[model samples]
Structures are given as structure tokens and as C-alpha cells.
Target: MFFMFIYYFLFSWNLAGVFGVDSVKSVSVTEGESVRLNSDLTEIQRDDEMTWKFNNIMIAKLKDSKSRFYEDNAEGRFRDRLKLNDQTGSLIITNTSTTDSGEYTVIGTSTDSTLNIFRLTVYANLSVPVISRDCSSSSSSSNCSLLCSAVNVGDVTLSWYKGNSLLSSISESNISISLSLPLEVEYQDKNSYSCVINNPIRNQITHLNITQLCHMCPDCFHCGSTEAVIRLALSVLVGVAAVAVMVYDIRSRSFQQKREQTSPSNNE
Candidate 1:
């Protein structure tokens, strides 16, 4: 073990990475997706701290001070949206769109050497994930299920969030339905349950799902089918138009023959 350690120390990729690209090679980011970056900042020296530059402009300084998070020069548009997670060397931008997309670089320096430079592309999304009412099946009898949640969320409570607002309590430890607890009101709004999850260190989000017993096989709880009705109406209108055109053509031809006969043009 000791010889292997010595061999690794003398001729290992660790030493080689100090001169080459130790981080991301190339990454593709969708218009509003994430690009994960995992790296170590400890190799940086005190005087040789890294600086994040966007399009040739300095945005932030790395690990210089507790309060001195990221270079303070982040572009005006990205003020509150650019999240620099120091723990994981992760960079996150929310609500990605096309204009926010660009080339970003991390320039790290050592005692006297520039270790490596990593580059990434960023994108923006104007719209967030819509909390549509999904009525999928779940193991719980409450077909009132929510799904398509964000993956890799750390330890966080699940609850409802509406348009950047917390709609309910994070902890659902003792939620109970009681007989005296306004059963009428509950019946009126019993169809939807919002699923929320959040952690203190990171952002929280809520996705909505829907109503009870959507599966009772049509025992009179009929969810309206707007599309089917529209199609039916359209079909009837087309049929009426066809009949009207046929009648109009026949009447016009008959009227023309009668007029010719009366004018003596058809007598010969």
C-alpha cells in the first residue's frame, strides 16, 4: 500500500490535472436545463484565487472571504438568479431562456501557475414547470397523486408552492381528516393535492396533482370532455353546410331552365 501510494504520488493523474483541464471538458445545456460541475477549490492558493469571468468580464472571486461569495460582477440580468453553491462547485441558473445563454469560464490559478480553465454554456427558461393537474395512479387510494418531480433533490420537506409562494406547511407528519373538521368545505375542494419539496440550503418547488376517485368507471362523476363536444358540433355543422350547398345548386339550375323556357330560348 505504501509503495502504491508513493507511485501514485509520483506519477498520478492528480499531478497531471494541475496543468490540464481538471474540470468539465464540454457540456450542452438545454434552453432551460441544468449543467452540473463538480470541482475542488482547495488547490487554489490564497493569492491565486480563481475568478469567474463571463464573456471577458470578471464576475466573482472564489473563496476569498465568507461574505465575498462569487465575484460580485455577475451581469445585471442575472442578479438574483445566478446561484453559486460553494459546497459542490455547482452553478445554477433558474428560468433559463435564450438570451441568458452564453459561454462562461472559470479561471483558477495556483501559487504561480494557472491550473486549468473550464468553460460552460448557460441557458434560461422564461416559464417554470407548470403545475398542471395530473391524475395518475398511486399506491395510495388517493388517486390524488402528484408526479414528475425534480430528481436529486436533497433532504427537504414536501409541500405546495404556488408561483414562488409557500401554500402549505412543509411537514405533513400529522395531517388528519376529522368528522367535525368542516366536511362540507373539504368535499368542495377535495380533488387537488399539491406536492412540495424543499431544503434550507436550496430552493423549494411544488408540483400539483389531482382529485379523488377519477377511476369509478363513469358512475355519474363525469369530467366534461370539451374536445369531444367540440368535434361533435363541428361534424354537425359540416353536414349542414353540405346539405345547404346541394339544395342551393339544384334550385339555381332549375330556376335557370324555367327562365330560358319562359324567354322562348328553349322552345326550338
Candidate 2:
């Protein structure tokens, strides 16, 4: 084992002249998109050899003007999605996902070895914000609380706004960040509030109209159960009184008819 380590150490030092790139570059892209990791080489020479690796694992190679990809070396998430250009030695990854984020290195060998490093970051798109109001305390409308929430977002920020003024903001770096922020404000007819979710590549928002939310309150119907019951009782009494008056009028007419018929016999 000691002899093997020494052999590898000597071999790496000898190849050091061919792989000279050590600088790191950062690139960010939204999920489900495409990104190109450029080699910064316009063309490859006839004697030049190029290799692309992910985290030091060789995934692709260019030899004698031909491009080759080793399926066993590619990560499962990147398999079948990696494309290499034979001329320039750049790599294109299609339909990238969060798991595809990592460091990629390209080594080119011709007269001298050149190395290019890329740190790729894949972020999921920001989700739309959902805004809701809590008005449980009926004492006053000025103490209502508004909540703004977003889920399954990445490299993004969530913020609250009242017209042109800012209320609160939160940011996260996780690939699937989820959070909520609350704003307490007085409800008014002309009050306007909004929630914003945004990243470098995309933006989402939701609006809250205070007047509309207030109209959803129970008291907004303008009447309670007691008032409805009183009105119903008055209608019933009016209906009963009309029925009694009609019965009395019918009885008086019947009695008058009978009295007239009996008096006619006296004339005979």
C-alpha cells in the first residue's frame, strides 16, 4: 500500500504540467432549465485532449477530435443529459435539477495543460405567495394580522408590502425553502397590502385588499339572529289578526240572511 501511494504521488506530479486550471467560477440557473459550462476554448487542436469531470470523477473525454461519455462515470441524475461539443470542449446539461448543483472541472492538454472550474447552483423557481387575514378579535378592525406564505422555493426572498412602503422580508438558501411572514396593521377602506416572492430569475406576488377582507366578517351582514327572530314574530301576529277579522265578517252576514228569511212568513 505504501509503494502504491508513492507511485500515484509521482504520477500526479508528472501530469501536473497538463492540468493547470485551479480557479473556481460560479453559475446559477433555475431548475428545469439548461446551463452551459464553457471551457473558454474556441477550438481544440489536433493533438489536444480534453476531459470533463464532476467532483473529480471523469464523465467525458475528447480524443483525436472525437467526443466520448463514460456512462459508468456519470451521476444518475446527469446521465443521458450531458452533451459535449467536440470542437470547443464545452458541456451542456439539459433540464437541470437541484441535485445537479456541484463543481465541474474541465482539463485540456495540448502544448500545456489548462484547467477550468465551475461551481453550478440550481435553484427551484419561487412559488406564489398566499395572503390571509386574521380578524378574530372583534373589538376593532385596526388590530388585524396578515400572513404571507410561500412553499417549495429556493434561493429566494419573501416580502410584504403596504402600497409603496415595505413591511417585512425573509430570505432562504435551501433548495426547498418554505416560510411565512406576518404583518399587523389596522384595517381601513382604502388600505392596500401585497406579498412578493422573488428570486434572481423569477418573481411571484399576491395582493390583499383590506376592505374586501373586512366585508367577509360576520357582522358585515348588518343583522343578527335576534333581529331576524323579532321580524318573523311580527309577521306572524299580523297574519293571525287578519284571519280573525275575516271570520267575524262571515258570521255577521250569515246571521242577517237567516233573520230576513224568517220575517218573510209574517207577510204571508
Candidate 3:
């Protein structure tokens, strides 16, 4: 019995591949947008019956030029969002969300059965990329540290760009989480920089303001670099030595004047 069932399944699949099965169509759409799955049929005859299924569960049907939608199916996930075209037996989904992403199949029956498949990917609206200074980084006076981030993102790419050229990039797939990318640039750099987050449907970008974010005071010193700290210490020591020398010279001049006055009095 098991062998017979396996043989029948394989035979059915092979026949489907040979005669009426079409290639799987790829469809991508952003959340809150509408998408249509084509049936590839020019017209539906009076005796034809077409059914739409999602994950192998029927959600819609077209028969005898009449259309029916099972909005309450799939745990009511398709409620008030499904539309069927009786003429071509196509299905349209309105106000789509990320949960709508899945495999959809359509089967038509009359004298011969026909099959059409679609792979749908519904992406959430991309959040704006946030650019901020990375204060925790060991940044030097000559270089600025920065981080670009996005939250609750999936199947997206985060990148840093210099003018129109790509600098660094990171990508994630199949998991929703926060994404962050780091960048470093010279404090006096005049070139334009930007951070971008993108999915298949849309992208978000944030431009970098080098002068504003990378500003450093003229007298500011950085302890992160040993060389810079050593230079600053040498400057402070030089200033203190010069002040001590001037004070010593003034005291010596005063002592000499007092000794000369005392000698003249003693001679008198």
C-alpha cells in the first residue's frame, strides 16, 4: 500500500510537470500595497471551475461565472482582503501585510486540469536609517566614529557609502532584528557620506554631516592615542618651565638691589 501511494504521488507530480503546470511566478510588494496573482487564463468557460489555495488550503473559488471568497479561512487572516476576478480567475489581495507572504496555487478543472503557482513576498515598510556618533569607539582627533542603525528589520541590506561609491555593507535574511553598521572618516573630510537601508521594494537613506558631527575644539586633547597624550604633556611641561624661569630672574634682580643699598649705608 505504501509503495502504491508513493508511485501514484510521483506519477501525478510528473504528469503535472509535463502538461498544464506553469512556472512559479515571483511577486514582491511592500506592506499596505495591493498585489495581483495572475491565472494566465484568457477567459473562464461556463463549465470551468477555478480554485485558489494558500499553503494548500482553499481561499477562493470561481464557477459558472460566479466568484466566492472564503474570507474566514486561514484563521481569518484573509478577511476582507481577498478579491477574485470571475472572468480570468485571477486573485487580488488588498492592503497586504507581511503575514500574507507565502506560496499560492491555483487549480482549474474542466476537461483537463491546469495548475499555476506563485511565490509571494510581502515586505514591511522600511524604517528610516538613523545616523549617530559612536561615542564608545576609540576615536582619534583625526578620525570620526559613527554608527548607522535600523530596528525591526528583516531581509534587508545596511550599507555605508562615500559619495556614490560603496564603502561597507551588511545583509540579513529570514530574521527580524536590529541592524547596525559602523563607519570611520577623517574629521576634515570634505567628501559626502551616506547610510542606506534597502529591501527589494524600497530604500531609506541618511546623509552624513561631517563638519557638524565630527567637530573638535582647537584646544581639545584626545587621550585615546598615546602619541597625542604625550604631545600634550610635553606642551604643558614647556609652559610651566618658562614661567618658572621668569619668576627666578625677577627675584634675583630684587636681591641685588637690596645688597647694593645696604653696602652704601654701611660705608656712610
Candidate 4:
């Protein structure tokens, strides 16, 4: 009897595949959006009947040429959110949430068995990542420690990148809360770095410029020490050289005038 039951199950499975219901359709949408699962049927004849299920739990049924929700199916997460079309057996879900992501199947009972399957993936919208510098280090080295964070998100990954090269990444699963990631880089590094927050559907990035931040730190860029001394020395040397040249020119001119006055001129 067990062998017979196995054979029956295999035959039923194969029969389901023969009806073109084996291929799974993929659908992706953002959270709080609406999605429609197409039945691939343009019209349902008067004698046709259809049924829709989510994970094999019937949510909609068509009988006696009338479309309606199955008894006790319009409750919980699906309450007031499911719309069914009687003519085509298509199902539309409104204000979709991440919990609504699942496999939906529509079965048609007519002259030929029809099966349509859809795997729906709903993603939360990515939030803008906030980047902040951590200046708590006691060392004199001006290395910048940056923290990137986002809140109230789910199924996301936070990453740090130097240009196109990925440095670090953190991923969260099924969580809708706050998280953060950090990166430390040298003060003089001119490469472009960015913090990215992403989900399956969207991503947001914030760019960082370490050189700009280092301009204010004396220890990092040597802001006011070396360069300022060099500038001051150059200015003093330039001023002294100008004064000496002026004094030498004046003395030479005065001596020449006196010699010309004392010497007998050819015309005199």
C-alpha cells in the first residue's frame, strides 16, 4: 500500500507538470506597493472555474460562475487587501508588505487543466545612509574613523567601498531596525570612499572625502606648522633683499654725483 501511494503521488506530480504549471514566475515589488498576479487567461467562460492559493492555502475560489473569496480565507494579513477578477481569475494585492512575499498559484478547472505559479518578492525601500566621523581616538595620527548608519529597514546590506573596491559589508535578515558599519582610513588618502545601504530592490550611497576633513587638523595635514614657517621665512628674506638693493643703489648714486661735481668736466 505504501508503494501504491508513492506511485500515485508521483503520477499526480508528473500530471501537474504536464499541465504547464511547473515553471515558477518571478515578481518583485517594493513594500507598500501594489502587485497583480496574472492568470494568463484572457477570459473565463461561463462553465470555467478557478481557484487561487498562497502556499497551497486557498484564498480565492470561483464557483457557479461567480468570483469570491473562499470561506474563512478573508482574514488575517489578507483581509481587505485581496481583489479578484471573475472574468480572468487574476488576483491583485494592494498595499503589499514584506510578509506578503510568497508563492501564489492559480489553478483553472476547465476542458484542460491550467496552472499558473508566481513567486513574489517584496522588498523594503532603502533609506539614506548617515555618515559621521568618530574623533574619539587619542592618537595624534589623523586617521578618520567613519560610521555609517540607517534605521527602520529590513533585509539590507551596509557596505563601505573605496571607489569600486569593496572594503567591508554587513548584512541583516528579516530585521527592520537600526544598524551601523564603520571604516577607518588615513587622513591623506585621496581616494573616493562611500557608504552604501542597499536591499534587493534599491540602494543609497554617501560619499566621503578624507582630505577635506584633514585640512582642519594640524597634526594630520600639518596645517599651521611647516607651511606657515616656510611662508614667513620667504616673506622676510624677500623684504630684506628689497631693502638692501634700495640702500646700495642710493649710496652708489650719491657717490657718483659727488665725484662728477668735484671732477673738471670737458665742457667746463
lDDT of 2 by residue, 15-69 (tens): 7644545457889998899999999989988778998888878888888888788
Root-mean-square deviation of each candidate, in angstroms?
Answer: 18.4, 9.9, 6.5, 9.2
How many clashes in each structure? 11, 2, 0, 0
Task: Find the candidate with the highest TM-score and give its number.
Answer: 3
Evaluate all candidate structures by whole-model CA lDDT and list the values in order. 0.45, 0.76, 0.85, 0.78
- Model 1 reaches what TM-score against the true structure? 0.32
Q: How does residue 217 of candidate 3 score in lDDT?
A: 33
Candidate 3 C-alpha lDDT tens digits along 51-104: 999988889988998889887888889998999888899999999999999999
Best by lDDT: 3
Which lDDT tens digits does candidate 1 get at residues 1-268? Answer: 9999998887777767655556445554545564544344544333445555556565555564221334345446556555655543345556554455455556554443333354554422112223432332222232222332333222334445444554554332222411110001122243344444444323334334333322332432222234544666899999999999999999999998889888855666
Between prediction 1 and prediction 2, the one with superior lDDT is 2
Model 1 CA RMSD to the hidden true structure, in angstroms:
18.4
- Which stretches of model 3 miss by more than 4 angstroms? 1-19, 174-176, 216-268
Score candidate 3 by TM-score against the native: 0.74
At residue 45, give the lDDT of candidate 2: 83
What stretches of model 4 exceed 4 Å from their correct place?
1-19, 63-66, 70-74, 111-114, 137-140, 174-177, 209-268
TM-scores of the models, in the order given: 0.32, 0.67, 0.74, 0.65
Comparing 3 with 4 on lDDT, the higher-scoring candidate is: 3
